[model samples]
Target chain A: MKLKTLVLSPQSRLDEVCSEACRARINDYFEPVWNETGRDYTQEELSERMAEAEVIISSWGSPSLTDEMLQKAVKLRAIGHAAGTVKNLVPKQIFAQGVKVYSAAPRIALSVGEYCLAALLTSLRYLPEFDSAMREGKWKIAGLKGRELTGSTVGIISASSTARAFIKLLAPFQVDVLIYDPYLSEEAAARLNAKRATLEEVMSCPIISVHAPKLPATERMLTRELLALIPDGAVFINSSRGPVVDAQAFMEELQSGRFFAALDVFDKEPLAVDHPIRTLPNVLLSPHIAGASVQGHLALMEEVVEDIIRGLREEKTMYEVNEKMWEVMA
Target chain B: MKLKTLVLSPQSRLDEVCSEACRARINDYFEPVWNETGRDYTQEELSERMAEAEVIISSWGSPSLTDEMLQKAVKLRAIGHAAGTVKNLVPKQIFAQGVKVYSAAPRIALSVGEYCLAALLTSLRYLPEFDSAMREGKWKIAGLKGRELTGSTVGIISASSTARAFIKLLAPFQVDVLIYDPYLSEEAAARLNAKRATLEEVMSCPIISVHAPKLPATERMLTRELLALIPDGAVFINSSRGPVVDAQAFMEELQSGRFFAALDVFDKEPLAVDHPIRTLPNVLLSPHIAGASVQGHLALMEEVVEDIIRGLREEKTMYEVNEKMWEVMA
Candidate 1:
């Protein structure tokens, strides 16, 4: 028997992912939104389309499948996200309905971690302005006043895939690694060559990077108080979530010249024209492109497609947030 | 016979290099400038210092030993500069005095070379602003966009010592190295994993660093026309003397986003406050501290002291700019 599935978000190579689902004997693959005009199924098109879909694969900018949509799709079995976080589209309603969901957060983990390592090194060397100065043909020697990473302390503030992968990438460097994740066991931190510390200690480190999820307990992990504990000129990276640090407080501190920063994300998307962050010389700012590299997309698609194939074969989900196990595990 | 040598530069750690010189049978080290009673020296005092003084070790910023000063000492056999270039004090008059001049350019070459390499890597990574961003408690995933050094092209504009060290450092990264020194031999380039190239091709490279000496031939080696050949977003570093680059032209190009540069030296030291270079956001202007690190000072002193020792042992100078060699070797 074939298990029907619908993909909400359309990638350029939909054929590639569809073929993988086909290999696992899931014969039906449809994008309900794409099927327009003259189609006989008019009322509740999404519901009608997904009513029989055993799995739904989603990506960035995917439409949320709401309670009304879920009500009609009584046969909805699983939701698979091929991106970093499901919080963007996967609603609380999905959990309430007992719908299973999966995410390839682990696959995209290395991309963020690799970026974090580069950001870490960049911060230690004071390179951002050095490069800009070089462009202007001014031989500024202040760039030479940077600390080597050989004996510096690096604080990793999470135990998620990004944080874990960051620790793995830093193994070759001579940094004194400290990690602060309540979920991480002492044995795990030991094996990872990182000393498990409290959030207090991590923020006080010479180099601190945040990779925690946006759970209630983790939101605002780098609050104003925590930010004050951070050392001057130390590098801080946040690839986890934007709300982890308070932006207003950050701008105040940055203006005071008490520390240095490399911000790829912000509490608000597309920081307004008057944002102080855009003008600061000490900051390395972008439009949040770190985890969206070519390599990042490649890893995500590979992992998500693999899960789609395996789920069809074994009739089980991987990286599922809405899995039944969460009910008992929670 | 003891060879009395006068130290012109006040290197407190002068003993370390002198120790080696003493071991090599160099003797009678003296410096009258170290005395506060410089109003005048009695004939007895002058004879005690100059009766057997066979060598003088000098460097940049050293006071010239004029005809009047030299007349007080008749046995001065050789003039050695434990630093780069002798134009500062060794004028036509000193050469006319038939003093065999030696410079310790090679000894400090390797150290300056290391600093240049560090600058290149730091520029490539964009670390300084990132560090500031980290301190400001800003967490952004898009703070920096980095390019790996692997397979990247780096053009060396000259075969100076630091340039050679940079080529050696590039060996590990497997970068595409190019050289454009008119005086450089194909064999020398090959040994350093560099392809001998025309000035045009060298300029075409994305990473170009100037290591030419401040000689008449190399004045403004990187003119406005040469700057045009470089691709956008390429890195330019100058650890060599600043005259090789036209600051105004390069600064203009950098402002227009046509090039990027990291200059440790400038045409004018302490770059004037009103200097347009300082106002430009793209320029990394420093106080010419690239070759002025603690290591750089130590290296300079070590070489000068070594020369003093070697002068006593009748050893060949570490860096001899033979007036005769330029025709055949330069």
Candidate 2:
């Protein structure tokens, strides 16, 4: 018997998350609702679809499943999200109804990790300076000498999924990794092949990457004092949320030219035209595209589809998230 | 008893290659000539110093040891070169005298390998485009999508020392590597964890890196047809000598917007003032500084010093270069 699954995401994003093969697998396994409709359903429309949907497939931009929605979705058994986090999309009400939830967080974490690794290695080589010099017809410039990642110490903040993935990717390089994660035990750090360090000690490394989740405790963890503690010529990277770092302090640090940074996220999206960091040569900024790789989306979709199949069979779910897990997860 | 050693290199480059500790060790192990002098001796001056010297320490800018110089260097048992290759520095006369020759080629190869890995990862992520766009205050570009190295096929042009070191570094990444070195047998390719591929098949990969030595048979191996066969959106990297690749074909490919390139060496260096490739947004150009990292020079010095100590002790030198090895080595 095939479960009736309703995909709650905007139709335009369906192909972006799920490859054609993945979509075919979902169709083959589940009696999908509205196979070809490109509709982002309104509340009234969702109410009609909820009447028959035993399982829901959600992704980025899907409307939150509230208590009232759950009351209508009496048969709703599970949600498989083809995106990193289910925090914003899956509410406590669904769990109250004894619904199961799974996400593509692990796959998204790997993609972000790959991006961070690339950013760190690129900054270490002083690639931006060389690229600009080449464009301007300058052969070489002062302070543009390349540095090798080997024999250098790398500092990682947080034991978040992305950070763990990044650490795994670094196994081949002969580098010492220092990790600053209050939630992580010393033994846990050793298991990750990283040395446990205080925030100050982590900041002192020549290469520091932040992957802490955005929360009340982690917000502003990298304060003015912490940012200033970083060594000169160190490459500071933040693919995590901006508030997790003291943005003002970071801007000041960049202005002082004491260190370099590669940032994917900022406190504000589309940072103002007059923002000083935008013009700084020591900074490498991207428009929050670290987790937006095409392959990342496809991988997430595959994970979600597999979870859906597993849910139907009542097998163990590797990426499930409950209300308790949500409280601590990024 | 300390062996008598004469330093033949220019004085200015001493600190760049040999660190203070290295110089101290050399002084303790050997009765080094003048302990500290910046003089680059002429052939007559070298011949005068060679009479008592049991070993010679050489580097860049040291004059070649000719037949007449060798006749005067009756006591010379070995020549330690603190640089990449000894071909240009060690003449046939040195070999005829049964003088052992050693070079810092292995250390130099590692540094070049590190640079190439950094270049490959940087290009894979479209980092140059992102850096330039961010500098220009553009938050998002049309085609600045990031690509993960996982599952990507990388094509290597040779089984050179640098290429072998690079293969080791890539062990952690989930990538398939293909090699097109004619000298490499199928078994040898497997040992390097790379599959053997023809030039045409190699060029078809999404990422192509050239590490082939500059030789008569290998020169211009990446021909016009081969360059055109490269898949669209692929990254073409050449940290090796430029003549190994067909320059005109590569330039034409870049102009057509079919692929991107990261080039350290060029066909005509300080590439012409009005070179079209210089200003292309898709091309990344560096002033041939891949193997010029500061640490690279230090490592080379350390290797040469160790080889000198081993040579004096009459032990087998790991870095010793024989006539047979020199012909095939880069």
Candidate 3:
């Protein structure tokens, strides 16, 4: 018999996340019941569906699985989250019930990594500056020469999945990569074709990218002193959580016009209209979109569906998130 | 005895192209005569130096080697050009006189390829749009989702050195690459991990890039109908010569908002102040700098110096341009 699967994401999101092919595969493997509502399921609605679901599929706006809900979900053997983080969707209590969990964080990391690389290349080559000048009827502005990515030193703040993905994309550039992550061993760094360095050393690189997770320990890890270490004419990119950096310090450094930066996240969402950063000439600002893409969304659904199938077949799933991993994952 | 080498480029350019280490290496290998003047040598000045030199170093702004000057250079054995396209610098007669020639076209190609990939990623992800919106204090504009490079198809207009470098940099993206080059064999396309396709078939891809050379046959190669073949929401990039495309047709296509483009070249550069292209919303304009960069300039000097050293040692040079190759080069 096919597993009784429950899809908790709203129909509108499902339209984007799950392609027609993915839905066909889901129908082939499971007796699936999807959320037909145009919005996220209410807690009462989720509680009612939990009792009958042998397998659950969740995404960005899905209601959290509480202990009360877990009590009703006795038939739930697995939960596949078609989104980056399951931290908000799956409570620790669900793990105690012996339910398997899978996440599409790795898939999201690929998009984020690609964004980071694009941001770096764009900033390093002064692409925006050139485009702006050209639009203003200028040509080859004096002293506007750009630098190449080849044979340069790149510093990564953490060896998170997104950081690893970015490093993989950088392999062809012949650049020296320095990674700063307390958890990354020398052997692990070597395997990634990078050198393990202190946070200070990483900050000193001409091109520094941050990919730290949003955790208490990582909050404001980039202090005023560390921000000061970045050299003149350097390009700083931050695609990870905004809280991982000291907002005041970063702004002060950028104000000096000694370096350039591409920032995709902020300490607060929808950066204020009159925010000082908005007027800064040395920075390129974008809404938090490093991990959001149409292709990435579909890939997330495909990954979760495949993992759910592997779970039913008693096979190894690539993205399984056990209790230990969940606690430390971003 | 060291070879007598005459540097024909202006001193200002040498300061930018040749690093201190490169100058020291040149001193060690040859009795070098520096171009002390801050301007390009006149034809008469170049002819006087030609009589005493066994090797000649040329770059942008250097006077051309006319047949009259070639007759005066009795001891000339080699010419090393620290720039792309020696077509403007060397005469065809130089090859007939048995003078070895080396050009840094490959090094410049590396920069152009990197620029193309950067342009593709920037346009695909709608980075410029997002940045603009964010600067205007907007967040998460509706229906602004981007596509990924991971699984898309990329069309290349030619298999020139710049195109090959771009294909190499795309190795990790897992995107299908279609190259439109009549001279490229299926086996050659396979080596690049790309498919050989007709011009029309290549133009139909969602992401189209042009790297065609500026030759009599290639001029206006991308006609109105060919430009119309581009699908909606596609990204078009051109880092090669602008005259290779029909400029009027390209402007009209971009005006329709059916596609986005990042153009670095124009039929006539310093694009007119009131040009309609400057006001277009769906296009990103940049001065012709795809093949120019600080690192690329130094690399050009380094490559030519290395090749010249190899020639003196009776070793095969990597970037030697023979008569047959020069006849077909850009």
Alpha carbon lDDT of each predicted model: 0.63, 0.81, 0.90
| lDDT (tens digit, per residue) of candidate 2 on B1-330 | 777988776557786788878878878888888434466777777777777888888887777777777777888888889887877777766776788899987787777777777777777777777766776778877755777778889998888888887888788777899998888899999888899998898889999889888878778988999888999988888888989988888788889988878898888887776677878878777888777777788766668888878876888787899888777665
How well does candidate 3 score on lDDT at residue B258? Answer: 95
Chain B TM-score of candidate 1 stands at 0.81
By TM-score, the better pick of 1 and 3 is 3
User: Which one is best on DockQ?
Assistant: 3
Task: Encode model 3's per-residue lDDT on B143-205: one tens digit a residue.
Answer: 998778987899999999999989988988999999999999999999999999999999999
Candidate 2, residues A155-210: lDDT per residue as tens digits? 99988899998888888777899999887898999999999999999999999999
Candidate with more favorable, higher lDDT: 2 or 3: 3
Off by over 4 Å in 1: A1-58, A65-83, A87-151, A159-176, A181-204, A220-258, A263-330, B1-202, B210-226, B237-256, B259-287, B291-330
| Inter-residue clash pairs, candidate 2 | none
Tens digit of lDDT per residue, candidate 1, span A170-230?
5534468889988789999988888899999999997888877666776676788888888
User: After superposing candidate 2, which stretches have Cα over 4 Å from the reference?
Assistant: A35-39, B34-39, B314-316
Off by over 4 Å in 3: none
The local lDDT score (0 to 100) that residue A294 gets in candidate 2 is 67
Two-chain complex of model 1, DockQ on C-alpha atoms against the true structure: 0.09
Order by TM-score, highest first: 3, 2, 1
Query: Which ten-residue region of model 2 chain A has the weakest summed lDDT?
Result: A34-43
Note the DockQ of each predicted structure.
0.09, 0.67, 0.80
